[model samples]
Target chain A: MTGTGGRARYLWLGGLVAICLGLLALAAWQLVVLERQMRIAATENMIWVFGQTQIEALNLALALSDEAALQQIQTRFDILVSRLTLLEDGPQRRFLENAGVSETLARWRSGLLALDPAQGADPAALRAHVTALVAALRTKASLVMSHEWQSQATRLDSLRHLHLLALMSVLGAAVAGLGLVAILIDRERRLMSGQLDHLRAEKLASDLERERETSENHRRFADLIAHQFRTPLAVIDSAMHRLTRRSGGPVPPELISEKAAVSREAVARLVKLTDTALMMSRLERDAVLPSLRAHDLNDLVSSVIDDLMATAWDRDPARIRQSVQTEPTVALCDPMLTAEILSNLLRNALLYSPPDCRVDVSVFQSRDCIVCRIEDRGRGMSPEEIECAFDRFYRGSGHETLPGSGLGLTLARDLARIQGGDVTLSQRDGGGLTAALYLPKDDVA
Target chain B: MSLRYHIVQTALMTALVFMAVPAAAEDVLLTLTGAVTDGRVEMTRADFDTMDWHEFSTSTSVTDGRPEFRGVLMRDALAHAGAEGSSVRATALNDYVVDIPVEDFHRFDVLAALYMDDVPLTPRDKGPVWIVYPRDNHGVLADIRYDMRWVWQLVALHVQ
Candidate 1:
């Protein structure tokens, strides 16, 4: 795989490991806490049972001077002592030893047994002995309880330390994982940036190839046009020279006039062809950049109609009727290009229609665009002609009487596209043709 | 009723009342003397073997002497005395009295002994009758209070 993808995988794995480790540490800490709690509970229970039993024995000793009571108390005390002895030798033995509880119990027992009812002379002595015994027992019980409490505290402290260590280790692992991820991300970013630079270099090379192809196509077109016109110009020059240098001084006037007229018509035809070629070239170059500006589309349409009125009137004065069929709208475009587009449509309308046929020019705003329609009430174009209207240098076969170059609609479509607009010709449903120009509103432009 | 007839009825009633007194009311009484030197007491081997006495042993210990004891338990003694009450008041001849909790007797062995070191004890030696326990049997009975299983003398046991 690519370096960036590899690094991403590494980062994902690290994050997953970190998460698992974190959960494991949390579980371990929880277990430790639970175990510590259980230990404390057990210790507390043992201490409580031992204390209660001791108290009962003390009360029994005080109540019964019978030797049997003492014996029974001693027996019960021995069991407690054995348990305590086992505890002393176990994990918490140091705590019990430090409390000095066993010795205290031993001393209390000795004191009680040493008391003599016969030698006491007064009840006070016996009471004192009982009091001493009780006090001693209390001391032993308190010591055992305190030792247990201290052992619990120690265990708690140890548990806290263990938890803290676990937390620190987990944190350390997380930090390490984060560091790895950061490194991986940085590496991935570097790789992606390198890839982007490579792609940009490739794009620049591709752009250079396209520009080279465009220049070659232009060169080939210019060469073909220059070669085609050179022979015609040579023929015209030769004919003119021969006419000027004739040996017979007097020539036939009819032949001279006819030849001169023919020559003049040929030259004119050549000029027109040259002009069409130049116009096509200009349109092609203008595809790269158009002279865009805010202009009233209604005024543009009106001006084109006025320019074409003479031609339309020559066909049939009544057929040249025009009307603005829509509200005034402004559009962002080249005015020359707009006029050219409208003139072509109007001229076509006049050429194809019979006398008294009307043509309409109108403009309006639709949503965020300006729409201009040129409707001709004349012989409409066929579906095939309408579909191919915007193709370069295409002339319909039915337009034999019309004197026109087929580049008009093509130039208009190119201009519209450059200005972020479009032009379309559709056969009217009833009759004639409708050419619609859609231009972006000035604000949208 | 005549005075002689009244005297006769009172004599008869008196004689009948005397007949109702228990034989134990006429038994010989023994008094205890001197301090109990041994931290614990137990039955003499002789008394333990000969008498058909109530007996029991407990693993628990008294705080007066040593950690352990093996002897006739206090509950057995109280049971033999037909103790009807919840309390046992044990008094020495010198009026040294201690109230023995009845519940304690049920829990551990507390014995009255007449011997120590396998010999009959003398009064001067804090014996003739003493309460003793086998202190070496368990470590819990090592306390000095278990040692207070008084030795020198033990007298009346009153159940209340």
Candidate 2:
């Protein structure tokens, strides 16, 4: 995979880790809150139970006659005893037993039983017994209430302690999570720095290698041109010298015309070779960075079409037709680079078109980008040709009849990439070729 | 074992009879007696103003109708009487009595209401006085500790 793609993958992984940690923190906080609420609910329930028990005991004591009151008190006492057992092992349970309030109640119950109404009871003795019973019931109720209060206090204290501990733990975990995030970010930064350094080193080495290769190719081309020129030049000069040395025979017009034509062809070949070498060198070097500015893509296409007008005029009138589908297609880009790409595509379309065919140039805005297409109605290229169409010095099979260096598309593609765009070639719908330039709109400075 | 011994026994018997005559008369005339010693009592204007004894009222029910007597609370009267006792025995004119512990009185507001509404009471109205509480103030008091603050022909507070 490419370096940028790998970096994006790493960033995605980091994002997932951050999301997971966030969810974990949220879950922990929820649990802590739930536990706190549960503790509060338990304390409130205990308070309610204490209040209910006291009220019930008071009501039972008041409703019955002395004989009956004792039995009711006994029954209530039994219920309270059972409830006390349910209080879990705590200070509340201990308080109930230690108060001896329940024993006092039992004694009062027996005292009430002894004072039978059938016997002429002495008022003093009866009053004393009732008073003792009331006192015993009040003491018992107070003991139960106090025990509940103490239990609630203890539970609240423990809950507060637990809350504090949980809060501290959450804070600690959050801090650790933050620390982990920072470390991960730092590691990622270091990795990116290392990768950048490696890329820079590799690029520098490749640049040096490319420079050496270009120099060698230039030298070899110059030598090949010189060697190609030498044979024709030698023939022309030797023939002229021979003719001059003889000084007796008149030179034949046909023979002189043939020699002149041969020399002309050799010079032309030399010029073509030089121009091809220059184009190759231009394509191999990186294009200059574009000074991006907003410009009308439609106007740029129109201007390129104007430049190609003279060349199109040389072809059959019907074949040289051009059309523009959109106007005022505004975009943010380097106008010069956009013009260059459009000019190259238009040139290719016009060059490869058959006689009496049409070349269409269009500029339009697409979603978040601008598209410029140049279509030609001509014999289309094969898939292989389209694939290699943007490569340096590549010429299609059908382009043998065309007199051109094959570096235009390569140069255009390089310029497009520098401007954050690309060039693509495809077969046209009918029977021709179409070239498209996709330029990204500059939304970020 | 002669005439002087008979005379001493007869004189002791007469002295006992004389002491018993006043006790019987007090029971028949007063209808209620004794102080509510120990603990406290609370009264509100809705019942009777025990603080002012002159104005009293009574509520009539079929089971208990008597004159209502306006007076200070039994506990307060006992306090005023400077009585010292561990309990208060509240008795109706019919001789029905309930012993209220001093501690219970301390913990609860046991009131001796002298009025029902804003009118004077008679015996047929079931009161010369009664004991009452503001039971409607809380749900926990909606039952019998409140009901024990009985109305009608209320009579005596005996300190024990």
Candidate 1's error at A328, in angstroms? 8.3
The DockQ-derived docking category for candidate 1 is incorrect
lDDT of 1 by residue, B27-107 (tens): 322321222213222333443444443322332222222222223455555443345567656664333467666655554
- lDDT (Cα, 0-100) at A39 in candidate 2: 26
Find the candidate with the highest DockQ and give its number: 2
DockQ of 2: 0.02
Deviation from native of the Cα of residue A389 in model 1, angstroms: 3.5
- DockQ of every candidate: 0.02, 0.02
Show where candidate 2 strays beyond 4 Å.
Answer: A1-95, A98-100, A113-126, A136-145, A247-445, B1-160
What fraction of the reference structure's interface contacts does model 1 contain? 0.00
Residues A232-348 of candidate 2: C-alpha lDDT, one tens digit per residue: 567567766655675668877876766665556545545544654564566556436588887777777777666655333243444434454534466778887778678667767
lDDT of 2 by residue, B40-68 (tens): 33223333322434423332211133334
lDDT per residue as tens, model 1, A1-445: 6889888867777776777577567757766775545432233444754564465446545544443544343333333333333243223333445666544443343343344333233344544666565666666677678777887788778778766766766677677667667776887899899999999999999999989977875675566456545655765676677677788877678657656655665465456457656767876665346688998888887777766553321344455455545465879988877776676666667666665768766688999889887777777888888888776556677763344556667777776777889988898777988888988889944
